[model samples]
Target: MDNKTFSLQTDLALYCRTGLYEPQTSIQEHTFHYRRLVYNVIKDTLRRAFPMTRKLIGKRRWKKMVMHFFEYHKCQTPQVWKLPQEFSDYYQQVNFPFKKKFSFLVTLLQYEWLEIEVFMMEDLPIDEFSIEKKSQEDRIIPNPEIKILSTEYPVHLKNGKEITEEDKGQYFVSVHRDFYTKQIQFNDLSYPFVEIILKANEGCFSRKDFIELLAKYDSDREKIMKLYQDFEQFALQNTIFLGYQI
Candidate 1:
């Protein structure tokens, strides 16, 4: 076939596969059969990456949601690995009949996404761990990898069901590598400290200063030191304290 013939055929197949028919073609029978097969594979890939998000909405709604995205969104990356980040952005705009039925469900989906994203999103350069080499007087900036921080706007939940918010609270989440993957988890106090560290604000509170900042909350010196030690251990295990490039 000539170039023009080939181009016209490709365009017609694409348009027909997407449900917008071009002029009727003799080629339709074979191409349309393969089109359904390809589309189903693509949709299933999306569903797997976002299974929790799918379970949040039932199967039928989830399939419709994925189909809408596949039809509308022009995926920018040539690599399929990058698709989940795009899916996450799409996940935010979705509103099912009873979407917020589980108060922390959406947040949990986001949290799970971040855990996987951080571990795989980019490569951290390999480097020697050397925090032990720091002198007692050495002043150090807290490394970014030691902290996973974020804030949710205008909504708060307690016991996973009661939702209300007067103000946004900073969450200081911890991300650490366990075996081959990074894990994200946090307790109430640690979340705020992680947030402060990541903000890296000028005249911002130091990790040591974090204890002082929260002094009024619980003034037991032993407990405060224990918190610091635990976070330090987490940082060390994750290679953040040693300034491993990330």
Candidate 2:
């Protein structure tokens, strides 16, 4: 075939493979078969990326959701890798009466996504340009890696459902990357305090500023100090506290 004819044929095949039921007048049965193969590839990709999501919805529903997604959305990005996020987004939009707890499922999936994203982050040597290190009176910068820090509520899901208000705001978690995997662990007082440090004004923070930030939150001096010490040690061990390069 000429280049033009080849390109036209390829595009037609891709369109059919993407679940758009185009008439075979311009294409052929082979085009539909090609489309089915594409659907399976996409489905398996989603399934691997979201085991929890699949399990949450169960096999039958999950299959239905994936099928519906394939039928409707033409994911045209060169970064085909982002298909998982798109799937998660679709899950959030679906209003299954049984899925009234989607709010929690969305959050959990988003959290898991962050964990994966962070784990993939390459270590940038701590910036030497300096954000003015907090002293006995300075603020701290929230690390970009810290996603979803809240004063109340550590978001979680139970059997794929979000726990309701009665159990809400009872815990906090700090999600961070460790080498190659995104890891999430419950936050101790120190983790939240690290969050507080990040929340400080955009410049250097002094020791006094740091101390005051803690005090503003009514973080007990003795207790927080102990927590801080323990936390610093933990960060060092985990390679997360990369000592200020400044």
Candidate 3:
């Protein structure tokens, strides 16, 4: 009703959500009900966002971590889907079940979350057929939703199974949401291409350097140039579909 009343009510609701305190009054009981409701909603949102992480950890541990996140983590974004985007950050800051046991936990969370993040992005949506081939020195536009991720584990090959030594190979993964199908796509990008895309996204890494960088990967000039052609072709065909903003 008043400022003090609202503040107390808010605090009480938060406490209930955190499982720190129970409702004391009729209104507080309603607050508790809504608090639990909101907690479950946020939990479900995170569960969808990090399905692989949840699978890796199991329901009990995942629920416990979710509760911990619910109690201690402060969400910066108002959007529900973006809530789990901070889970990895919180996990890193807070030493919990995944403190050191799960080496790929944070990276796996990121790889999984990228699907949701990219799918929700608002991009310019350039068509592949309309995109023109540009020289290596020219700055080429890249898909806005594309995220370049590098990790020791083959996070791209994650199939909900627990991690082992065999999954320890380093990988460069590009996850983007396709404009035509609006489906999330995974591309295992090569060395120079990965570097080029990462820099290109930042408004750097022209086509000339794109080929030059690839050339460094191989001593054979003709083979390296061919790789450049294929790389540029893929970008023009698929990546352009996500369209370029800058």
Kindly report the root-mean-square deviation of model 1 from the true structure over all alpha carbons.
Answer: 5.9
Q: Residue by residue across 1-246, what tens digits does model 3's lDDT show?
A: 899789777676567567665646656536557677888898888877887788788898898898888888767777787887787678778878555777778788888878888888887544243244333345566676787788888778756465676778768988887656878889887667787777666654555666777766788988888887787778766753323324
Task: Estimate TM-scores for all models.
Answer: 0.62, 0.69, 0.81
Query: Which candidate number would show the highest TM-score if scored against the true structure?
Result: 3
| Candidate RMSDs in order | 5.9, 5.3, 3.7
- For model 2, what is the alpha-carbon lDDT of residue 53? 69
After TM-score superposition, the amount by which residue 103's alpha carbon in candidate 2 deviates from its true location, in angstroms, is 4.7
Top model number, lDDT: 3
- Give the distance in Å from residue 215's predicted Cα in candidate 2 to where it truly belongs: 1.1
Ranked by lDDT, top first: 3, 2, 1
Encode model 1's per-residue lDDT on 6-91: one tens digit a residue. 98766665663475655456675665665577577667667666665566567887777677667666666666656766766776
Better-scoring candidate (TM-score), 1 or 3 = 3
